[model samples]
Target: MENTYYRRIFNGCLFLVPALLLCTKNFSIGAILILLLTATWYLIKEKRNYTLDKIDWMVIIILSAYFIANIPIYLSDMETTRYFKGASRYLFIIPIYFFIRHIVTETTTPRKYLDWGIVVGAVGTIVIAIYQFYVKGMPRVDGYLYSINFGYLSCSLAFLALTLANSSHIKKILWLSFLLCCFATILTLTRGAIFAIPILIIFSVIFQSKQNKCKNIFKTILIMLVFFWGMYAYSAQFKERINFTVTEFHRILSGDVADAESSGGRIQLWYAATQSFIKSPLIGQTYAQREETIRQLYQEGKISDWPISVKRAHAHNQYFEMLASNGVLGIFAIIALIFTPLCFFLKHISKSTHALTGFVFVLGFSIFCLTEVPLEQNLISSFYGFVLAVLINFTRNDLDNIQDSET
Candidate 1:
């Protein structure tokens, strides 16, 4: 009876994940429920019987290391929620991984609601973004989420939908969805996402070429290009963003950092972060301290004209943020956090059809992290955690035969 009840809750969590993603606060609550139920199920039934393999251990070690690295801050300054929230991110992978794995292994229907759930969420958001763009006349439409996160979600979903377009009947709806997502992404005007999606699409085609045949992938690429061209030609906001990017580059060249707020601000933050890291490279500062440090640098004129308002912001780059705030340990933990799943998914890419789905996810996150700290935000971070858990669990050998042939 307990087993049956846990299974039902597990399936419900899978469906709730995507639905809850439409709102950040609800998603947080939903994620907590998932963790609690997963813990209850594991403790009651699977604790002694379940065994983790090497990959699982590696993932857990990375997460634990990250958690430990943040302990110093939490111990020293228990006042702020920064340490708790930062540390909580590392906790997500375990319950999420185990819960999804249980559903896949013990249940007859695996990820039945998951794939469609993601699409349902994406389709609804895309429609809302469209309305915001045309009817609301918002230049950059973010839908229910922040603008940059909307861009990140759109970029990932566009690639995910591209992969799902492998089937004939589902292909048309997915392709249309993919196009709409691209439109929504362009409207976000997030330069990193705008740049990354094209590259992701090209690389995805190359990655799938062996299985998809060069001709079909090329045709799909061409169709995507035509869509991109249409958007580029028609979207005034897109053109203005591109023009602004060019202007920012020119300002950067002229050493007018203030005028290059869009791009140059990141460069200034990187400089400040690097200087701060040199002071304590082994075990970096806490989040609050880091903010204060940057604020001091800005005051000292060391950081030069970077606004004080955003000084409390972590380094815009994830790698830089990890190094600046968490030091060497955090860097190693993040490397493991990113690459372990990447290596696992890449290793199984050719063998499993769902492998690319997982690959594109990490790839999208990595690309986004290059410029923006996507992981720091609760919505994007939780979104990544939920998606990664589902996709990585899908990569298990138990579901190999059930893989999508399109991937």
Candidate 2:
């Protein structure tokens, strides 16, 4: 009876987890109330003491450093609102990660719990993303996201589906999910998506090589090329995406005579960031301090033609943004948080295919971060962390197991 109850609780939470982490999906205060009730039931019923691993320690340490480093900013000329808004990220995301980790550990393994969740979440998110892109179009509201964000989300969903596809036990439904993910990624017209997908394919090839996998891959790529070309030809924005990608690719290869437009306004932002860094090199500016800081920079002729009217939140590059906003310790925390899992995963590449899928996702997102600040929004961070949590779950013998005819 106790075992059945535990399994039931786990299954319910499994469904709830993905819903909470999706873009188009929302759970109300009432839902949170219900979740609290069930979670209380699970907690009260628990017998064993919990043990957190090194990853947990790493997350806590980074978040702690992030908070501690920001204390000076809060003490400085920054507003109380700005202080809390900046500080709240550590509070919100950190505990939530612990909570997520607990929920994941409740199951025997994180693999299928999240795999099933993502399959459901990805399909639903894809539908909403598609609807928003085709039916609604652009120029979104104050609180809502633009259609282009959906394009980015599409790529993210595709990446997750593709990661799941890497496992030997991929079912037909999961394969179909991958197809939808790929199709939706294309529809987004995200040029970065175009560039990033090759990582997935390359890794897929690398892992599947010497196993007679290239033939199917070649045929699939041929079909996808035809589809992409046709779709690219039809949509002006998509065509522009292709053109811009090719133009930039060529420029990068050719050592660039002209056209820095590929990473539009990135140079300007980088310049602004460096100038900001130079002024207060040690402590750097607080979240509240950014507006006035940039304003002063523009007015003083330090950063010329930088838009004063636009409220800039970040350096537009993740690494630079952290260094500028959070300072030396903050930057280190960010680095440790990102790279710890990577280093850990690299050490345990007995399952190379699974490791390669994660690598592809990381590569894709790293490229995305170069142009867009994905972590700015709560939903994006929550979704990304949750998906990554799932991908990490795939590094398992049981999950990655294939049928052995010889055995």
Candidate 3:
């Protein structure tokens, strides 16, 4: 009876995890609440003697390395509080990962509910985005969050729905959900997010092909390409954006430092970040020192245009940010964070649906992170951490066995 009660509460909290991610305001609150609840349940029910698994150790190693990278910040003249807070953002996902792993083995019903919750949240966001577009005449449909975040969330939903659509049961509803998510992502007008869709399609085709369904997956990819291209061709703003990007690319090659366009600015920032990394290649610099480093480079005429009037917080690219802030260790941590789960997913993809979903998400988010600092912010990081933990837990051997036996 006691076990049953704990199980009920655990399942209820798990259902709310993904739904809370859709809300901009309640995200952190929900994350804290869920983490506390999970921790409490584990201590009270398990008598405080839980052992760490290999994946758990991997996460610990990453977190430890991240903390070590931040140690130099305190020695510098910067405020250690900010760096400490930033380093601790990933802590919320650890307990939740253990809790979900425990519950998932007992039953698969929660997976169904979790999928439905994600779909409902996606629909809610889409409706709000449409309303914002039509009623307010907004330039970009940002949904409940910023335009970039909305694009990332929409991309996540689209891929999740695609995985569901590939399943034999309930294909019709999931296909509609996938189409809705794709439409929502398009409305975001975020070129980085838009670019990730094709990569996702290609990855999906490759994964399915390994399962000996290459012809079907290839046809689906072609259809998606046509629809996406049609959307681009029909939307005047999207076309203009693409043309602007191309023009900016040429300006970059011409050494036109005066081009303040997004693409050109990104190129400049990448160059600045690479310069910073070159100076402090091992441990890099603190946030304060990194700023000063960029400013110093500009003063030395190393960077063509420093935009002295504006303050630059990060390198715009996550890889560059890690190399600048955390140095080589940070780079290794980021790589492990990405590809460790990838190795597991690829190992189990031939047998488990959960593995396929994990692969799609990790691959898509990794590609998304290349150009944008999506994983650096609190809200998006929490979202990624929570979902990633759950998926990693899903990849456990027992659950895979359960899924295999049931199938």
A best-first ranking of the candidates according to their TM-score comes to: 3, 1, 2
The better candidate by TM-score, 2 or 3, is 3
User: Which pairs clash inside model 3?
Assistant: none
* Per-candidate clashes, comma-separated: 0, 0, 0
Minimal lDDT window, size 10, model 1: 397-406
Candidate 1 regions exceeding 4 Å error are 1-5, 23-35, 45-47, 76-79, 106-109, 164-171, 211-225, 287-302, 398-407
Question: What is the lDDT, from 0 to 100, of the residue 193 in candidate 1?
Answer: 88
Comparing 1 with 2 on lDDT, the higher-scoring candidate is 1
Q: Each candidate: what lDDT?
A: 0.69, 0.56, 0.69
What is the TM-score of candidate 3? Answer: 0.89
User: C-alpha displacement of 64 in model 1, angstroms?
Assistant: 3.4
**Residue-wise lDDT of candidate 3 within 291-340, one digit each (tens)?**
77767767887664543433544677777777777678677767766777
